[model samples]
Target: MEFWTGLYLMSFLNMACCLPKSSYTVYLNKLSFSTAQSHCLPGSFLANIPKEEEMAEILKTIWDKNDKTATSFWIGLQKNKGDCYRKDLPLKGFYWTVDSSTQSDVKLWETEPSNTCLELRCGLLSVKYGETAATCNGFVETTCRQEHPFICKRNATVTCRRPDILGTHDIIDYSNDKDTCYVHCASGANFTLKCSKDLVWTVLGNQNMDTSQLCLECNKGYRRDASGYCVDVNECEESKPCTHRCLNTDGSYKCACSDNDMDDCDGSKPPTTDLTRNDYSNVNRGKSLLTQPTSLPDDVRTNETDVHIEESVGDVSNIIVPVIIALLIFIVLLVIVAAIVKGCIRRRTTKLSRRKAEAVALNGSNSMEKVNEKEET
Candidate 1:
């Protein structure tokens, strides 16, 4: 039996036993058996009546046409010239052209063939006896060269509905054939699905729908490994963006300072006395301090401690230098004011002395004048 036919009978109980009623099409134009077979190509083939129910369906179709001129029709059953007859076989060495494995136990032949070993024979269904016959069995064996109207069978086109079980970043695409579907995931992975002839959808490689395997590009702070799995990215090992310490998380990273007193991870704090002493010792040992070292021994000073010491010394100098300059400026102004006061005192003393001398000279002149006037009188 055909795969679709068996599936319909076993799984889809609502459908007909063999091919569905809609699957068959009758062509009234008469043509040879080979020509008829060729006519149903690309998507269909000649009808295979492997069961009596299918033959009854074909007969009903012919009766519905109500054409008295139509008497016989070619089916898909045929026997090659070189094939030997097998009496024990259900089909007697004959096979359905559509599927050679098809078999039937129901005897629908009108009469047994006289030459059982004859070849190049094809199957035909005749209704000349009577349309209302109880058996409706009119299977006839005839030459391939005979011209007759034939029937073709094709599977109904069925669409596999889109699956809603996809991630937000997943994409779905249908192929030109419409039977194939491809799934693209954000993690740079892909899977395939196919619409089977029996109207069923199946995954191509039995792939699971897990998001871990479907993603192509991982989320932030995550990366794809060699085995195509999304793994956590260790930013601390790769870029070392932290100044003191680094910690890795599920999808991100964090930085931390070794000193508990420090508010941030940048190592920004004043150095203690021990740290200052160690910094000087390291400086005396002739170690280059231009670049900050990431790590140091217990005895040696760390670069962060050195930086704190340098900053503290710089801050002290920045304050003391300005105070000393202000004191010097104040002394210079005091000396200039004292010199002006001393010069003013000397000028005042000199002016006082000159006034005293002039006054004495005037007194002497006055006394002499008085004496001379007395002598004259």
Candidate 2:
């Protein structure tokens, strides 16, 4: 039994530690190769030219439906040899952005040699030319030229997640580790948050520790009061937000009503009045028509009656004003639509009448032409 239980627990823990989802997005803004690479900061780097099959997949993902024409794109392929005009010669090192792997078996270049300019050594990929080398700093406005849009590949291993902190609007940055995140605190201090690998966010700093090397002070359930000292939350000060009398304690507070009522206090209790229930009952006639009371109040039922009457008037006004405005708008739309339909009917009738008159005139001219031919014969 103990062996089976331990096995099940290990399986559960393994499932909980699955990898996060990965995503990649294309940017259309035209930028220089170096500048475009720098823009993919925080957690991503410039897209690296992948292996033959992988490059095809990446291009397929970024294939734009709106712009089907293949544009020039920058890839993470470059040679660092001082001599520029060497193609078959051994390169010092050709590497991807993150991984320093050599670009060997994947050959996707045109037949034309790339070193037309002595300074051209950067790699460019597109539909026409599978892969070609060019000057990294060259530029032109035309499509398929050196200056064009590029695709940036996201690092699949790294995932950025926002931290859950109260009263903080600062942006949180994610990293390779799932249990860690970078955030800015209320004191304008920037720090990396790392707890004991727990799911919940726990402040890992100690107050008694030295301040030189990243000290996190506050703990859960305690905050800096107005006097800048950490104090326990007060429950009885009505900030406990209890509806009735607040019972203060060391850690929390409890609420209880004098009449032993559990319902939320809506502050609608009636005030004392001289009139009896029957004398001023007629005043609440319109109000009771909407929401009838379930039971009777104890002391000042007359005051409660007036409160309901005012609420009914307010509700009726809110309903009536919107109905009137909607009716006016509907009438205006109906008039405009009717005018448009009438104009269309009038134009159609005029067109039919003109066609009939033209036909009659043609028949009359044909009869005259036949008479002239008979007279000549």
lDDT by residue (tens digit), candidate 1, 152-237: 77644434566444454454665445656666656555656665433344556443323334444568788755334568988778
Candidate 2: residue pairs that collide = none
Evaluated against the true structure, the overall lDDT of model 1 is 0.66
lDDT of 1 at 369: 65
Which sections of candidate 1 miss by over 4 Å? 1-22, 114-118, 129-135, 157-377
lDDT by residue (tens digit), candidate 2, 1-377: 99999999999988767745333456677776667667665456666654444565555556532454545666655544353434663222335555756554455453323443334355555543223321122211121224556666666565434445554435454556565666564555565554321223434463232222222344444454322345566645635465445555455545544335443333322122334445445535647532645444444454665766877898999999999999999999999999999999999989866755665577786755665565468
lDDT score of residue 219 within candidate 1? 84
